[model samples]
Target: MQMSNRIKEIIEVILNSKGYVTIGEIAKQINVSDRTVYREIPEVTEIMREYGVQLNTVSKKGMAAVGSLEDMKSLRISLGMEKQIYIVDPRERIDFILLYLLQQDDYIKTEALAIDHHTSVPTVRNDLKKVKEQLGVYDLHLIQKKGEGILLTGSEIEKNALMINILLNHADEATLYQWLRREGDVSNPFTKRMEEYGYLDVMSACYLRMKNIIRDQCELPAMIKDREYLEYILLIAMMIGCHQKGQPYEKVFETENFKGEEQRVTRQVKRELEEEFHILLSQEEEQYIKWVLHMGMIQDTSSVYTVKNRILDSKIHTFIEYVEDRMGLQLIRDKELKESLYVHIERALTRIRSGMCISNPLIEDVKKDYEELFGIIREGADRIFQDDFFPDDEIGYLVLYFAVSLDKVMKRSFRILVVCSGGMGSSKMLAHRVEQEIPEICVSKEVSLVGFGQENLDEYDLILSTIPLYIDKRNYLKVSPLLSSNELEQIHEAIKRHKYKTMRKITVREQERRQLESRDNIESLETLRLLMDTGLRVIRQFRIVETREKDLKNNLLRILSEESLCSLPETEEKMKKQQSYYIPVTDMVYYEAVLARMPEPKLFAAHYHDDQYLSNGEKYTDVIYAVYPDQASEYEKNILNRMLESVIEDRDIQEMIHRADEKGVRQWFGYQFKQYLAELLAV
Candidate 1:
């Protein structure tokens, strides 16, 4: 889907400003209602169909967009110049006061503003009237101090402006704009000049931004304006830029005040950077970079070294290797100057931290722009991670190629064992097939059928088999008789069952916690444990029961007649169905005689020997255990003896006694439960 030109313009404007612009602001820009703007967003997004543009809602603020520099450039090209325009139209004196308040360095009282502008206090008071009107258009406000002065309340816009100014101050706008103008013209003179400065991609642009800052000094609002201090600041920014571009440059900062301190720190930084990034820098440069980064940069610079839990420029390049191995992608080749993979790497690392679990999508995007030598191929799904479903043919191919890549970096050979038999022809065929499937796998040995079962299983991490053989110990996964349809189906079913079990536990726990909201009789440890055990048993048994009228009707009758079966639905559609039985019930109760005599005494355990537990072919469901849990362990023999006695004594009057007990003496109800169970069972 493609977004309308209007909505596209709104997104570009929001991103370019780097501030949370409200829906009203966007509406005014395109001359639309707040409702219309909200309606267009989702619809326009569907049209664009690009996941690269991220939309987020800020608390107490409005919507905002975040994307890469390339994504930003694309958006800008689509929106054109209409989106860049900002109008500060104020209708009242307060609005004017607010604007002036935001711009002024010192607080200005209404009396002061009146005197400065040669106007009366009433005139200045009248200017304050426009403040509310301006609030509807922009995220700005003015504070009145009764008599002291009026001050600006919001400073987000100023913060953004400061950052932008710092970034753009190094290169003249004309030169940068011209380079931007001929963006796609690879052979253009401006492009060539940018290339010479190492600005091939956004990395180059960032390099320039840093380079200019280093070459020319900057003065923050907090600093007293001085040419010498300003010059040093610019040099500091340039040094950061050079470090960003992966360039090695000497540092000449005067460190006489803390020469010893600087020298010790500089040595550590150089050693650390070299050990981490595999890139070496002189001790002087390292110290200069460290001092500037720690003291000069606005944001914390510690993150520069730590990218996604690994050192960014470490000697082992652990992060880079991990990303390459996982993402299966690489950087674009540029000869103008070798660009460090650090910039893109940091972003990717940040993304990984933000829940990017899979690397294929990110890798594929990079591969589109870089060729084979520069582009990385993920060591297939099998090599990077374990997959029980990996095919025998694909396995060999993946192993061979993946091993070669690992060998290039780590210089290690992997040993593989091929277990085959039947004859030399079959064994040779298996070896050839294995070699083709995983070209990188070095088959150290091939064994025949004679000792295959007795052979050491510890030699291989994975086993491929055409026939079943048992080797019980060690870390190993069997690829199966073949990577066939049945195997895949089995894996899918296993995963589904695992997921369902997890969901069941979560659902039951949530329901249990919710019981605190009401007086639910079933909410107790013993009752819950019984319910869990019963539910799982019923779930397992139902999978095997076949559909038949006799079976369904009998099961339903058995559930309906149970002592505390309570109730069930009378849905006509369910009754008319001639399929496998399914019962949805909230409660069930076990007969006391059965509960007492049974040794396990579990909540969900059900043994339907007759039709008493079912009702109208709906099938008996939700078996409830009725035994006293405290007496379970010690009184098992006593309970069985009482169960036989109750059968004979209350064989006829058990139901009547139960109803009477339920109404008056519920505590003594367990004593009569065995009698009711005996009569119900007619045993």
Candidate 2:
């Protein structure tokens, strides 16, 4: 078998190591399986033997190098390890083209690029096609002028977003900080380190200097919440600063989004930035800064799920129920699924409201992979929403959320190995606590540090260690022996990290065509993006009521009379008509736990008139009303029923009644009926 480049690296590590290292250790370092190492070891050994350097395998210890020091030195020379030349992968030439264009004042010839990379001009043209594909993701298009040259033209926000993606993709936590700390040229080792993450080179040192200046001069408002977001804002700042050296100010094209207080905040930020950097800001630069503060840093929406909880909850229920009926999957009981799908709905609503046109890079892959699921989500959304407006990208996200949950639901129990200290006292305590605290951890094996060496590391999904170990890796955890609050939190974080790591590894394998396909991998990534997004569409419709009407029955009848479409004064009479045409099933859901646990006392009521009711000659307008002095909680979000069905139990449904007017009641009733169709279809 032909030895791969990775195998060659492994040979170097084995040969240079002072002591024997196990295949597990090497595999962990390389982010592969021990079986892969085993497969390649023989080939590496054959290559090593040609230089008279022997590969020695110790039974339980691992592998070692046994040969003359000069012979080993000669082997390194033969492999060109001394001055390794980086041959950029074909997949990464696109990034090179992008970075190359970013630094240019005008479009350089494609032939120049081909010569720089020592490739044919046609190859450079092909690379440009891929560059266009990538730019399309950021909503920026490549402008190939007939005679002048090629360039990128888009809103400054879009440009900043793309630059941030390229600059951050190659670096880890340490290297990112390194660039921020050092003030020198950033000689990124792309071909050696960032082969998996696309290779591109930009003057990161200059950018980081701007970042440091920005940080030192101003205190960013809390609205600039995340580090990644702050970085994007700084990139925009750098671009503006770079352009400002020649022109004191530049005029920005789009100013409609920036007005009044937003414009003022933008000016203040610009003044502060200019003073710190000793530069002057133009009207355009000020407006661009306003764009960063408003859209990039400050929130465009209230918060994720800040909308009427019951309305969102109802939508989530309808989505899940519809998906269940269509896909034949039992999804209602999956709390994690419900949480994720609910978040997707919340973020989707927020994105729509914010008017931010974002595209999913994997939309094509999602459409191709889970065509049926995507259709089910779109169809289900239409059935649930009055005017469903999910873009294909949004639908892709929804499919991913559901697909990942389904994949997990279909997945079997995963095992974890717990490696403790040599002494059993603390390790046993931790082991027992781990078993008790984390019920999701289905299976576990307890072993000492030395005993861990005997265990097949591949068989277990994770390794939980109480003490620090020499070989730390993905799916490995180090925790305090006591399993304290912090330790438990670590366990929680470790689980999440392990999940993403596993998903990423699986995706890499699948994308490389090594594996057939893992729906879980793609879905996991989609779910990850939704989990990261924060914002929600805000609506204020809930009402509070206080009157002599203390009785639940009286309130129900009075609200029905005021809100019902049929003008039926008597709810009893309306019920009789509904019974004749439609069966009214009422569920009394208790909010004892919800009410007692509510942080604030917020009471509201809502009523929905069944669309089917008042159809023909029916005198009854089907309306359901519930009253509660509490906020809309998750359990109470959706009242699952047909015409004239009432739920007095859920916090959200009950809370809607307190402040519900005729219009609000009627609107809510439409949502309830949509969900009703989902439950009806299942039966």
Best by TM-score: 2
Native-referenced Cα lDDT, model 2: 0.54
Task: Write down the worst ten-residue block by lDDT for model 2.
Answer: 531-540
User: For residues 248-361, what per-residue lDDT tens digits would candidate 2 score against the true structure?
Assistant: 334344557443765665555566566656667667766656555555444333343455477888778877987776555577888777776765576566445544344464
Model 1 lDDT per residue over 557-621, tens place: 34433423433342211233222222121122233322222224322223333333344443332
TM-score of each candidate? 0.26, 0.41
Question: What lDDT, from 0 to 1, does candidate 1 have?
Answer: 0.40
Give the Cα lDDT of each candidate.
Answer: 0.40, 0.54
Candidate 2 has what TM-score? 0.41
Q: What is the lDDT of residue 504 in candidate 1?
A: 35
